[model samples]
Target: MDIDHLTEITANELTAAQYFHGHKCPAMPQGLRAGHLAMDFLSVKRARGGSELQAIVEIGDHHFSGCFADGVQYATGCTFGKGNITKRGLGKFALTLIDPAAGRAVRVTAKYERMKMCLEMPFFEQRRQGIPPYALDPAVVDPLIDDVVNRQWRDMFEVQTFNHYPVEPARESFEAVECAECKEMVVLPYARELEEQRYCAVCYQARVFRGQASGI
Candidate 1:
């Protein structure tokens, strides 16, 4: 659908997400809905910062061709910038929401049938045939968008609850170490010590690559 059509019909959060994501596709709204449902089920507010909630998303690199991550980020506020969202790369359409303070969590998964329906739709066929969603006929794309935006949660996903799930509280202290080569400070959880010298992962990899190259 055109920009004006999308703005008129889609929910405000999703409309903002489409603007941030730079395209209108079904997978993004699916992720947004999943995030919203997870938040509701967990009885938690949308995370304002890192400590309040954590989201483990299972969308792999080769999933449906769209920015599903952005949708989840927008809906849940568990963004990479906030250090609250992580990717599992399991090629599954699922996410686990954790509230560390309450020790409660839920795993929300898009039902296989729902995914199959999306795969069988004309939208997917057009995408497979090298037609972008915006380039396809609006009649073809608009209905898919509407379905994603309006579908009921029970109709789209399977949400499994885990009461008393153990969630560790956010770390409050870390030993800061200086990377010997880069001379940059590295945080404890991510700093690696090699040959008695601390290095960030990036610098360590670069040092290893250089060492191997020098030997060759």
Candidate 2:
């Protein structure tokens, strides 16, 4: 991430970074979509302190975002736990993932890019030791994490012109996301025309929401 020793980025290099920033990651699978993961972390040295912060992830389509607790740098993927990306004195952004094909980039903003820079180096270092696919948990969360990052990168190009970066939700809160009748979380089919229904067949409301029951 830190390229200080490596040849400095020139205006042309910056432009190239911006181009890649906009064009990466191809389309994902039907069940999988793209987005960003924002993790909030805290800073220690800032003078006006109660809970200081480092960076926040902000990438993906729909601006899908999340924020983790500050100083939980490991949680968010920021190498420099709670310092500003540019100033290091001013804490403003977090690392991001860039994917152009989907026309999006996770962590496509300045802050997120910095976060990517800081964290990526350390992550690779760890990889050198043993960690693979970039410190991602090999089993469960990896796919979710990977898809989100790719989609976010693609989305960046589709939405805005920009520089390098890597690039949540509240509801439309679906009260029904978790079903009361069946006590199970509902799953929505891939298409917009499809319906939202519980995964379980016996659930009372599933058929109704799926438009297979009722007056019709």
Candidate 3:
């Protein structure tokens, strides 16, 4: 989340593919890229209730073709969502050149591509504070939101995921089975207690069934 570190890394990345094998410049297109990113952040927040960015790094689009980071695709807005387009010209998506001694200067350009967007935007400047920028993508967002909402309901009130089972009323005992050997009687928990009583409780544990009930 350090913008200065991201800026340093972005400036030194290699973009030598067939698509991005253009002249490598030490500095970013200041005015254009920075301005576009700012605007995108504001618009995204206004519509979706808040800002959702993780780590924004400026890199060449071609370098992202088959590259992946932490199991996510590098480009095409795969980190967030492809359909996540922000409102035009409503936020801080402007490009500016930074000079430590002189001061940060804005660079004018036609338009800033999303890949060219950098992480120079400060966290405090964000409209929605404390929210990470990673969940902005629709693909990574919907399921996460559902998980949070459902987990809360489940934990708060022991809510079952599926339909509840219908409770059956208790039944009365019909016939009591008495053991002739010990005179111990037990009410059958289930129906049809015919062959259920072969031995008394003590004899049952002592292997008395072997002598009494013979044959299969």
lDDT of 2: 0.30
Give lDDT tens digits, candidate 3, residues 51-97: 22222223333222112121111211223343222222323222221
Q: What's the residue-level lDDT of 49 in candidate 3? A: 12
lDDT of predicted model 1 = 0.81
Q: Which stretches of candidate 1 lie over 4 Å from their true place?
A: 1-10, 172-178, 194-196, 205-216
For each candidate in the order shown, give its overall lDDT on alpha carbons.
0.81, 0.30, 0.28
Return the top candidate by TM-score. Answer: 1
**Strongest candidate by lDDT:** 1
Candidate 2: minimum summed lDDT over ten consecutive residues — where? 25-34
Candidate 1 to truth, TM: 0.82
For residues 74-182, write the lDDT of model 2, one tens digit per residue.
3222333223221232233334322222223333233345335434443334544664332344443344334433333333222232244332211222243555455
CA RMSD of each candidate after superposition: 6.0, 17.1, 26.2
| Model 3 stretches with alpha carbons more than 4 Å out | 1-156, 164-170, 189-198, 205-216
Displacement of residue 198 (Cα, Å) in model 2 is 13
TM-score of each: 0.82, 0.20, 0.19
134: Cα error in model 3, Å: 51
